[model samples]
Target: MSFQPLIHMFSITVESNTPLTPLDNVNDIAIEFLTHIGYLSKGYTPRSDAEDTSNSIPYVLFMDCFMKHPHKAWTADELAYELKTTKATVYRHINKLKSLDLLEEASAEQSDGKIKKGYKIRFGDLRKAWSFVEANVQMAMQNYRKTVEHFCDLMANDNTD
Candidate 1:
C-alpha cells in the first residue's frame, strides 16, 4: 500500500495585490476569494442546461455547510442532506477542502455510542487553518529551491562537452 500524507497535493495562485476595503456582502468576497485560493473553479461560467448554475454545489458546500458553521463537525451524510446532494458529491467537495489542508477530521460519539468521523475547519477557525497552507507552500518552495541549486551544481561539475 502506498502511504498518503495527511496533507494532499493542492495548487494555490500567489499574486501580489493591494489590500482593498472589505466588501459589505460576504458572497462577493467568498466567490472571488474561493476562486483565488483554488477552491472554486476559475473562470467558471454557468452551464447552458442549468438555469441556476451560478450557485454551484461546491460553493454552497463551502459557504453553507463549512463556513456558516465553522465550529460544527459535519458528517458526509449531514452535508449531503443539507445540500440535497449525494454522499459521493459531498465527499468530492470535502476531499477538495482536505487537499487544501483547510479541513480537519473530527471524531464525535453518537447517542448510539458509535464514534462517527466528521470534518470541520482546522481548529474551528479559517485563520488557523490557513497557517497550515502557508507552511506547506513554504516547504514546497524550499524543495524547489534545492532542486534548482542541485541542477546548477550538476552543470558546474559536468566536464564532458
Candidate 2:
C-alpha cells in the first residue's frame, strides 16, 4: 500500500506575517506548526501501488511524549514500548528529528537499571534547538544570495567580453 495519495494539505493561513490557525488549541497549534514546516501532514491511506507511508505514530509520540517531556531523555526502547511500535520505527522518527537539529543524543539509565542511548530536545529546550535550525537556514539563504550575485556579475562580464 502506498501512502503518497493519502497525504493531503493541512493549512495554517498567514496574515500580515503572522500565522492564523483555524483551530486555536495547543494540539492544533503543534500540528499546524509542524505541518507548516513539513513535519506532519494529513496522512493518506496507502494504495495498492504505493508503499505504506503511514506516519501518525511517530508524530504522535513526538507531540505527546517528547514535546511534553522535552527536559527528559527518552530511550528508543522506551519510546517503542510506549507507542506500541517497533524500535526501528522509533529510530526512524528519531533520526528525522535529529536531522532537523531539534534532538540531541544523550545517555540515560532505564527502569531496568541499564544505561542506554537516549535523546532530548537540544539543551533541553526546543526554542534553543530551533535557533540552530534558524541559523542554518539564514546561512543557506545568504549563500544563495551570494551565488545569484556572482552569477549576475559573470553574465555582465560575459556581455562586456
Candidate 3:
C-alpha cells in the first residue's frame, strides 16, 4: 500500500482555518474522503416535487458516531437510537461501510451482561483499517497485472502458431 492515504488525510481540513483533529473536523474530512473514493456524493437536493431524504445524512451520521465514540462497538439498534434514525437506515449505512471492508463484527456487552453481536471500525482504528483495504487493493491490482501479462503472452504465442 502506498502512503497516499496518509497524504490524502493530511491534505484534508474542515475549512481554511479549522484544524482537523479532536473529532471536530474528522466527520467533514471523512465525508470528503468518502466522496473522493466514490462512496458518497458531494451534495444533492431533491427536486421540489420529490420527498427523498439525503442518503448522505445517514452516511455522515454513522461516520460521526464512530468518530465520537471510536471504541464503542455498536448494534444497528444502538445506532438507530443514537442517531434518531431507523434500524433499517442504520443497517443500510452499516452494510455500506462493511462493503468497503471498513467495519468488523464484534461482541458487545449489554447493560444486563448479555453479549450482543455488533460492529466497530476494524481493530478500532480507521487508519489501520484503511491500510488493510489498501493492501487488498494493491494485491488485487498485482493479480490483475499478472493475468493481463499472461493473456498477452498467450495471444502472442497463438499468433505464431
Candidate 4:
C-alpha cells in the first residue's frame, strides 16, 4: 500500500508571536512516537498456527471489528453479523484472543433474567502487550533496513557498469 501522510491541526496566535511554520515532518515524528510506545506495529497476527488447521478468516474479521470499535463490547451474535460469519466462528476467534490475554470477559449480566457474558479488549494494563509489539517491530525494522541496504548495494554495482 502507498504511504498516507498523517496530519494534525494546530492553532496559532499572531499577537503572541508564536511560530506558525507548518510541520514538515509531523508524520515521521508521529510514526516514531507510536513505534516507541508500541501502538503501531506489524506484529499482529492470528493466534492460530499454520498446522492447526483452523480457518483464520473469522479471526481476522473479528480483529477488524474490534480495532474499529475498541470502546464497545460486542456480543457473539453481533460480532458474527458484523464479520459476516457464524456465531460459532466468532466464538472460536474470541477464544483465541482470550488465550492471548488480549481480550477479557468484562462482565456477566442478567438480561431478561438470563446471564449474558460480555467481553472487552484488555485495556486496563497493556504494558505487556505494548512491550511485545515494540520488540517485534524493532526486529522487523532491523531486517527491513538490512534488505534496503542490500538492494542499494546491488543498484550501485549495476550503475558502475
Candidate 5:
C-alpha cells in the first residue's frame, strides 16, 4: 500500500477580521465558522436552492451529527443513515474534516459485536481539535522555512563565474 500522509491534504484561509461575539444561535456561528475554515463552501448552493445551509447534508452531518454529539464516535454508515445520504457522501465530508486533523479515528462496537471504524471530534472538544490544526500548520510552515533556507544556501555556494 502506498504511504498516505497522515493528512492527505490540508488547506485553510487566513484573513484578518474583527473577533466575533457569540451569537444567540449556535447554528449561525457554526455556519460562519465552518465557512471561514474552508470546510463549507462559501458560495454553497444546495440542490434544492434552499436558503438555509443548515439543511444541507454536509452541514447537517458536521453540525448535527458531529458537533451536537462531540463525544460519540460516528460510523459513516450511521451518519449516512442519519443524514439520509449515501456512504460516499458521508465519507466525503468526513474526509474533509480528517484532512484538517479535526477528527480522531475510533472504534465502535456494532450491534452484532463487530468493531467498526468511527470518527469523532478530536479530544471530544472543538477547541482542542483546533489546537491540533494549529500545530499542523506550524509544522508545515517550519518545513517550508527549512526548504527555503536550503535553497538560499545552494544559490550562495554556486561558484560559476
Candidate 6:
C-alpha cells in the first residue's frame, strides 16, 4: 500500500528575541519527519467518526511495554501485569502485532516441562527500517510540496481581497 503523509498543521509560538533552541527545531523537524513518514497518521481520529471503544488499549499497552524491553520476549502473564490487563488480552494483542509483522516470535522452549514462547520487535532492525522510512518521507514530502504550491496558486487567483 502507498504511504500517505500526516501533515501536522499546528503552530508554535516562541519569543522573537530568543534564539531558536535545538529542542524547538528538533520538535519541528521530528513532527515533519513523522508526518512525512506516515507514523503520525496511524492513530488519527476522523472528524465525523464515533468513538471506538475497541481493543486498542491492549495493543497500545503491549507496544509500550515491548518498546521498553525490545530485546526481551515477554510472556502473556508478564505483559498482562505490565499492561494491567489479563493474560488472554495480552495474548490477543501479541497476536495482532504479529499479524501486522511488527513483532515476531523469536523462539519456543520448554521451561520446567511447560512450553514458553519468546517474541521480539521486528522493527528493531533499525538500519533497514530507517532506510525505508527515509525514502518514504522523501516521497511524501515531494507530494506535500506540490499540494501546497497548487493551493497557493489557487488562492492567488481568487480575488477575495
Instruction: Name the best candidate (by TM-score).
Output: 5
Question: Residue 93 in candidate 1 has what lDDT?
Answer: 81
Specify the poorest-scoring 10-residue window by lDDT in model 5.
13-22
Tens digit of lDDT per residue, candidate 4, span 1-161? 99784442211111223232344664444333333333333333434452321224433343455545565567786677775667887786676555445566655344566556666666634455445444555655797699899999999889665
**lDDT-based ranking, best first?**
5, 1, 2, 3, 6, 4
- lDDT for each residue of candidate 1 in 59-95, tens digit (9 for 90 to 100): 8888877888998888888888887788998898898
What is the C-alpha local distance difference test score of each model?
0.80, 0.70, 0.66, 0.52, 0.84, 0.53
Q: Which stretches of candidate 5 lie over 4 Å from their true place?
A: 1-8, 48-51, 155-161
Off by over 4 Å in 6: 1-56, 59-62, 108-115, 123-161
Clashing residue pairs, backbone N/CA/C < 3 A, model 6: none
lDDT score for candidate 4 against the true structure = 0.52
The RMSD of every model to the true structure, in order and in angstroms, is 3.7, 9.5, 9.1, 16.4, 3.5, 11.5
Better of 2 and 5 by lDDT: 5
lDDT of 3 at 91: 82
lDDT (tens digit, per residue) of candidate 6 on 77-96: 66677656677766765665
Error of 4 at 159 (Å): 68
Model 3 CA deviation exceeding 4 Å by range: 1-27, 42-56, 159-161
Candidate 2: lDDT over CA atoms?
0.70
Better of 5 and 6 by lDDT: 5
Is 3 or 6 the stronger prediction by lDDT? 3
Q: TM-score for all predictions? A: 0.82, 0.72, 0.68, 0.38, 0.83, 0.40
Per-residue alpha-carbon lDDT of candidate 2 for residues 1-161, written as tens digits (9 for 90 to 100): 86474332222222233465566777667755665565554453422232333336755667777888998889998898887778887887787687667888888898879898899889988889889777766766797699899999988889554
Put down candidate 5 lDDT per residue, 10-97, tens digits, no spaces.
6666556555565777888888878887888888866544467889887888888888999998998999899887899889889899
Under the 3 Å rule for N, CA and C atoms, how many clashes does model 5 have?
Answer: 0
